[model samples]
Target: MRKIAFIAFGIALWIFLTPTLEIEVLLTALIASYVAARLVGNVKLRPMKILNFTVLLAYNFLVAVWQSLKIVLGLFDYESKYFEEPAGRDFLEKFEKIVLITLTPFTIVVDEKENVLIIHELKRRKGTE
Candidate 1:
């Protein structure tokens, strides 16, 4: 059943994503989001809800790529003495902040179907709290 698949997937993810483990959080996020979009594709939402989810996913994907590029460029230039310089550190820190923000929408998009049940109180636990 779907529940079994979801549970197995979640356990597998957690095992691989152990706190100190070498898992790629971004990859896990993308997989979860794709699962969500499929689940919602079965829902009977208004046109706007479908559009909202699509736009959020698209933007989140774009931002993730952009942040990754910046992160890579940052690491490449990290040897510059500028690391000790306030401006350089500040730029790196700000870039990190942006990456964190980029993760938020992606996380929310992971539960693409949950948005349709926000008004319910069924105590169903979704991806994020």
Candidate 2:
């Protein structure tokens, strides 16, 4: 099932990318997409999960962009300090932490034993340690 999806995704991607699907292109897309899909098979993500993840990623990206813009504008606005130490939550797995850090500026795994995450922000949210 996953293989089929991967093949389909690969072919679709290839078609969108290339104007003309030559024999070589077809073979290349099939092999590349299959290999890529197999590699990603470890993650075990379904179409709905992938879509949800994409939406979450986009939301986080937009939030990050907004935060970054606010920080940049602060340079001329004189609204607040440049650096801040916002509180962070501990993640169950290091992989999850890594994934989050990839998407957002915050969420760094400080210590594995203590499971501490450090979030960099202009200000810590109220009521959070």
Candidate 3:
């Protein structure tokens, strides 16, 4: 069951990343997903969580691009801050959290220590403080 979920997640990710429907690409996605699922051992996979993560990642990517453009225009400034880990009790979960948090240009995971993440966050320069 978990393996099937992982395979489905992999296929969804592949399509999301490539946005292509070529037969060759799909075959490759299937093979790669199968191989990956086999290699992950016995870890559980949650389809709903994976889907939610994907949606959030896409949204964050767009926002990050916009923020990056603003930074280039000198309309924002950045500062370092610390944040607690919001989720994930294991290595993969922690890694996923790091990826999601760092995916946006407005925020980056600078470091991690004892379940705390050091983040660099961008702020609008003219905003009230």
Candidate 4:
């Protein structure tokens, strides 16, 4: 019964994902279904948890794509600001660098001795803060 359910679910998933199907698609889906069922049979999943996780994943994906589009559209909105860094905040600086690298093509470094941060932006858009 469980095996039949897995095979049916796999076929449905393959049909939904592929625009056009072929003999190869059926063969691949059959094998994949068998393997996936064997691998995950021991694990139990809740539908609500899966739904929540899927929604979160979709939301994050859209946000990331939107950010990338804004960057491409030259919406480099920012403001020149200065702040006093707390002493022994190396971890904060490293985290900031990691975030900037992931979200933008920008390089930032903190000069602890001088208590200054140097931000190098790849491009600047006019009239952006």
| Best model per lDDT | 3
Q: What alpha-carbon RMSD in Å does predicted model 1 have with respect to the real structure?
A: 18.2
Ranking by lDDT: 3, 2, 4, 1
**Which residue pairs show backbone clashes in model 2?**
none
Q: Comparing 1 and 2 by TM-score, which wins?
A: 2
lDDT of 1 by residue, 6-94 (tens): 44444454443345544465456456755754663443334464345445545666676675686568632221111111211333343
The ten-residue window of minimal lDDT in model 3 covers 78-87
What is the lDDT for 92 in model 4?
Answer: 37
Model 3 ranges off by over 4 Å: 19-28, 72-74, 77-87, 126-129
* lDDT of each residue in 26-46, candidate 2, tens digit only: 988888888877776654446
lDDT of 4 by residue, 1-129 (tens): 666676666676666557678989888888998898787675444456445544554455456678678779987575443333333345434443434333443333334345444443444445655
Q: Any runs in candidate 4 off by more than 4 Å, and if so which?
A: 1-30, 76-129
Which parts of model 1 are misplaced by more than 4 Å?
A: 1-42, 75-129
Error of 3 at 24 (Å): 6.1
The Cα local distance difference test for each model comes to: 0.40, 0.57, 0.78, 0.56
Candidate 3 residue lDDT tens string, 1-129: 888888888887788778578988889989999998899869866668777888988988888889778768976565555556554688778878888889876777887777777777765445544
Error of 1 at 32 (Å): 15
lDDT of 4 at 114: 51
TM-score of 2: 0.44
